[model samples]
Target chain A: MKKFINQADDFIPEMLAGIYLAHPDALRCVNDDPHCLARVGATPGKVAIVTGGGSGHLPLFLGYVGEGMLDGCAVGDVFQSPSPEQILAVTQAVDTGAGVLYLYGNYNGDIFNFDMAAEMAEMESDIRTRTVVAADDSAGAAPSGEGNASARRGVAGIFFVYKCAGAAAANGGCLDTVARVAQKAGDRVRTLGVALSPCIVPRIGKPGFQIGDDEMEIGMGIHGESGIRRGPTLPARQIADEMMSWLLADSPCQSGDEVAVLINGLGATPLEELYLMYRHVHHTLSQSGIRVFRVWVGEFATAMEMAGMSISLMPVDEELKALLAREANTPMFRQFSA
Target chain B: MKKFINQADDFIPEMLAGIYLAHPDALRCVNDDPHCLARVGATPGKVAIVTGGGSGHLPLFLGYVGEGMLDGCAVGDVFQSPSPEQILAVTQAVDTGAGVLYLYGNYNGDIFNFDMAAEMAEMESDIRTRTVVAADDSAGAAPSGEGNASARRGVAGIFFVYKCAGAAAANGGCLDTVARVAQKAGDRVRTLGVALSPCIVPRIGKPGFQIGDDEMEIGMGIHGESGIRRGPTLPARQIADEMMSWLLADSPCQSGDEVAVLINGLGATPLEELYLMYRHVHHTLSQSGIRVFRVWVGEFATAMEMAGMSISLMPVDEELKALLAREANTPMFRQFSA
Candidate 1:
């Protein structure tokens, strides 16, 4: 049970304080609330894109706050949803003259908390709010996307959703348009992850289950959600092939379809291994004649020190491609569209 | 010895293969030498910047090559220097009509190999080259910078040096000017690192050194170089305060001086913790009345999976500040000045 933390209870506040110190030019905490952060001077006339969820997943929820991305984020403790009060504070802090667009993963805690905040915003303050759930973990849904994507857990593909929606909002697109594009990107993007190790929540302990040295679980979620199966550890290429099989099964990415590929390292997985995994993913996608519009490989979202990786693909139409290519820079996640 | 690598012997090549796959847009292997990678189509008339060092420190030597950054990087085995031949290949691959500039940490192996490569380039290929040795680790040298800073080890401060020199060269500075800026940057930056946990090199085990559970080493190098001393573990703020004391003692940053701060995580440390460390660093600098021109918090350099962090500060004159604020984007590090 070795870890690097001060008082386990002081984790969230100390971490938020650190973010503010490091990114003063781009970010700031809201009204002395460490858990609620907003971009420095979000565009006054644009739709405010706000999101929140658990902590522990670096570059997610918080890291995407900046121009061309989120306007504000409500941060929770590790893997725990932000309280409704935290969400409401962030929602009020970043709302410009325009209404607010809420973006977050489709977890139950997040849904409940955000729903509560949205109701409060409507009743208490005359603010209009909309939400587009990011349920992009395709394997968490049915083998096919008939109706199960609604039930699937959200994972790293939320980055893509944020980018698409944020860019549209930054360009003065209305809240409905931003939400529509976000929903489209969220619907098109499919993700599948595999874990070779389990991690702990410092406040809690190690995840309840154990994984052996030679074993791995496919379709693992960031918070150690139940995967479909567990078996002997496969090589990088096989892992890519197996994940791609499920990814393609849920949503058929046909020949000539363009996609943006993201190979996200889940915590302890090395960047080198993630790229090795990407090599196979690229080859497999090419074999199926799917055109790679672009590729992103790095630690985008993580679960503490879980030694695993997730491959997410967002099939792009013209509008999605243009939005994905827009410029954005936060502390952790960044892209230069030019 | 839990690591996410495939074959033990194929480590370097496989890792490079993954890098190429993930970053074909920014980098390409030179002369089919997996150990040598160069930015694709470097500016044809600008003085080229090239660097190399051991592998395992991902996003370091190789990941820094792209627009407004290094033109090339020669890679080595995990924590081992690349061959002189590999170095020469990268030097020649990125050489524009303008001469080449070599940049690297002041490691023994790196100095020897890069020196040999520069000699070969001059003698055989008629290419002129200059070198900048970054020796920024304050604790790795004598207590004072009067004469001993020349012998200090290079760690995360090397990133600042690269940013300064690369931006200078990208601004069309001549080879000599670029070399001058790089040397000035190398001299002005000071860094101090502490390791709470030691990491292993996959080939061999933990370099035959052990620190007790309650103990930590201050001023540890990336290769676990001998630090100033060992003592009981401290909290994050205290670690920042202690490291700042050594950093300021070596290179006094007076009030009204502006500086760039980087809180680098040695592998296995979480970003949340790194940000927390930056919080204390910013507070200490503010107390000193030193302005933070910029702040970078994340893994710039690492000893694979070592649970510790280092703080680097470079007193930025007007020139160094502009160079740092210049735009740059490789796979891992990026900033847009707009």
Candidate 2:
């Protein structure tokens, strides 16, 4: 709950200014509105990619903007979506002569504002805009209701979409192509999370939710949404199996299905534990007839200092594999072009 | 104390197997040796860059091995150094006709063991090795004692050396040149840390240290070494000031000393707070006549779930600037070539 800020209202602006100052060569804020952070340059002919949501997930929306990733990001306060006007400004700023692509998480506020901004850019700026909403968090929606596609919330799996879409855009794909690739990546990905405790918002000065000292909630949302179940804290292997079962059920992966696995730590989870969880997750996936072609086990996306983790699986094809394998020269992600 | 491992002893080997299965193209482990992880078909004639440390810090020693960063990493148990024999095996495995450069942290165990391995390599294999220990933690050393040059302890600033040396070596710098560049980066850098709570090592099943609920310790080592002082928790801005003041005092910069600033979270600090800390740290640096040319704020090096952060500064010159800006295509770090 203890935070370092001059004023609660000025926190986002102050943070953006600092990010710009720190990464001047790699990032810049919109001329007046500090909330709109964008990669500097006229990315002409390339489908400009813009993603934004809350502010707590570093390297997610902002750290991902660079040569081969997002072109701009509109930031909100911690766990809050940017205003519609902020999104509009970022969309306009990043729109080169080529059309722009709006890629963001599927949080309610973000979905509403980004959609409004897309319409605004088309109407006023004569810039065509398309969108790809990342809906990878299976825990956000009822599994039997929509089959991983309906009303699903975006979580850490947004990073995979960014990489695939950015590579497509960088390869001179049109806005539609870039959007399609991102959408495909989003569709193929699914995530399930569990939380050991709730996070404290800096301004709120208290935990967002409560968990018993020896309890953990399975299939929890990033914002502490009620999970499918709560149980006594179990060993990490059992927890990994429990999460992997949900992800593997109804998965396109069968025996011999190639997939990418991401064992994401929700802020407070240590890397050591993440690797341990990854060990079990890999074992489970292998036993379930899936070959993990690529894996990223780290804190790609986070939920404050919440002590939990999520597992995301993305079925990969040759094109998806090639795009995923493309070189990305971002501050956070790097890959060599094969 | 709940962990994912079936047994504490199996943690490292199991994690290595999982990493190898996931990134077979990007990484591989030595035959029958789980401690040594190396890149597959790594380029020859380039100065082989090696880094290793405890297993808890993700993306530090292991996540950095790829095309343009470290060639190999020897991972030890949580917060412990790999044995000299493990270090020697990795060194030999990564050495491809070219001599190797050992770039590791400055912990006493690591230094002594790696030094012994370097000597063993000299006598056994025809491999010549140079060393560049990351001595960047300013708080660990007294200014008047051995000076920052000798007494500093390595922390997150090791990433900067990984970047510079990786670039230099990738650009065909000789072993000595790569070591010199890494050493220069190590020399110009300084870090200071603070912890709100001690991290609990999973295997140890207990907190590393104790602190009052409302108290924090500044200048704490990465492995929970006692800090310079412990006091009641203050706002993030004051904590940022305290950390920056000590770091800047150790390496007083002039008006135009371009530097790279890293606001590293010690595991449990949220990105929201880290960004807030970054805001204050940037402002403090500006007021101190230092200009930050590059900035990275993230959980680069963590100490389990310790609620703390460390700020690192590296003064940049033309050569250092070029090396810093050089393209590094690693799994965790990337920058445009200078």
Candidate 3:
């Protein structure tokens, strides 16, 4: 395993320290706990949005903490959920007179801890909190007709949830409104990913799964979870078309519908290839008579050094579109009006 | 080799088409040639800055062509210099009454072609052009005291050149002033890189170079060029200390200097590892009494999917710092004020 690391046990702390050092003006640790990070200053009387998830996905949970984005994040170890104490710490630090909202991916571990954190906040500090979990992975266990989003696992499409919900909170929306927006965005977005290679967790020092060099897994989860299909690596256009078909079929959109597209690199995939995928995705969308309002092509979320890409489509209304276009200044994402 | 590609020959054109498709509002093709890309609407009366180099380095040559940055870019094939005609096309399209400035990395093929393009622009269109070649790799052929920077290879530190020089042009500086600022930034920046593995060029379906599984090459160039040293991979801190020693030794920074740091991933390294490296870089600089003004940690320049990173340092003065802080909205980068 060729990695730039020191002691494996110190990985999370060291990375957190590095982030704080690099962007000291934009982010800070909460309650003297490095695992609980928040923006430098929390705005009073504004709904505070907090998220928490396992590590390995940069720009996902913690990287969104900044102005016009997430207010705080409770970081966890690799593929492991953060403790309830850490989540509560972030919630308390970010909450002002307004209530706190726990927005994160829908994982059993994360959900349990966040719920505990919410209960702890209510019992200990009398701070009200709400939850809006993102479960936008179209290829997850949930089927579209079942309407059981809680059975799905959130992936890169969670970015849309963060963008819409964070913007609502930044716009001084009430906590209930922010949670509603988060859930709406979460419901509207769908994601599908392909994995060419697996990433090694620091402590493990070996890849979690193995595949042939010329093979790939479609609909792979971020943490090397078994994908829906496995086959020989296909051409860029074919891969993009197949992924788009799955996403579009699962998403609720029609002819004349407008949406946003996110072509995300799952770590080692180059931006050049990401854009190539975007070309086909755009072409596919146009053929279906769908209008693309805005597009983002880069590594918004990653799975360590895994090699692959994920396509996310979010059908947007005027409300969601405005929030998506709002200026976001974060460690990992920045958006300005065109 | 595992790669997401169709025909190897279609790599550059397809990638260019994808870029134009994804960012139609911010960028446009020049003279019907996709290889020549320019900002959608160039700001007339402002000195135009045009840069070009081989493909594969996204955000390096074309990714910088947006607001507050380069006015145009002449894209070449993967690792192959673009034709002089392509460069001329970009120059002619972006240049207004104010002459153009040609800024790019110092390479034999690129310098020869860009110089020829300048002559063509002057003779055919009467659009005057000045040239500034970035040569900031501290580990290249040039020795620190040799007074021959031309022997050095331009690596990730060239980003400082684009950021500073692009800001000068955007601020309505004349061609001479912008060229001077570009040269000054090129002189102040120093870069060094390490490679744990090699990348495969698309046309050539094999790794460009090879190394043992446990070995790493320090001071390696972006294109798998031979480095200053090779040995077993060391811990993150030790690697940081060693690379910092080499960079600081070759640079002109003193104890009380203020500098901007860029920890660039050479493709496959994870953000977690990049921050671990940054933590050590920051600690080492602080211990030496060198204040870090700003830092950027991401894949600024990459070598396809090679697994490694590069460290770039530019000792900044008031002038350079102001330019670095200017707002830039590009396809790949966006910066806003605090």
* Maximum-TM-score candidate: 3
The stretch of ten residues in a row with the least summed lDDT in candidate 3 chain B is: B139-148
- Ordered by DockQ, highest first, the candidates read 3, 2, 1
lDDT of 3 at B293: 93
User: What is the Å distance of residue A90 in model 3 from its true position?
Assistant: 0.7
Alpha carbon lDDT at B135, candidate 3: 89
Q: Candidate 3, TM-score vs. the true structure?
A: 0.98
Looking at candidate 1, what TM-score does chain B attain? 0.96
- lDDT winner between candidates 1 and 2: 1
- DockQ (C-alpha) of model 2? 0.53
The models' CA-based lDDT, in order, is 0.84, 0.80, 0.90
Tens-place lDDT per residue, model 1, A1-338, is 44556777887788888788777788888878889888898677789988999999897879999889899999999999999999999989888868899899989999999999999988888789999999988767644333576678889999999999999998899988998999999888888888888877878755646899789988888988878678888656676788888888776577889899999987776666676677778888889999888888887888877778898998898899999999987778778984
Q: After superposition, how far is residue B179 of candidate 2 from its true place, in Å?
A: 3.3
Q: Write the per-residue lDDT of candidate 3 for residues B140-248, one digit (tens) a residue.
A: 7434323468778888998889999989988889989999999999889999899999989999999999899999989888888888889999999999999999888
In the order shown, the chain A TM-scores of the predictions are 0.97, 0.95, 0.97
Better of 1 and 3 by TM-score: 3
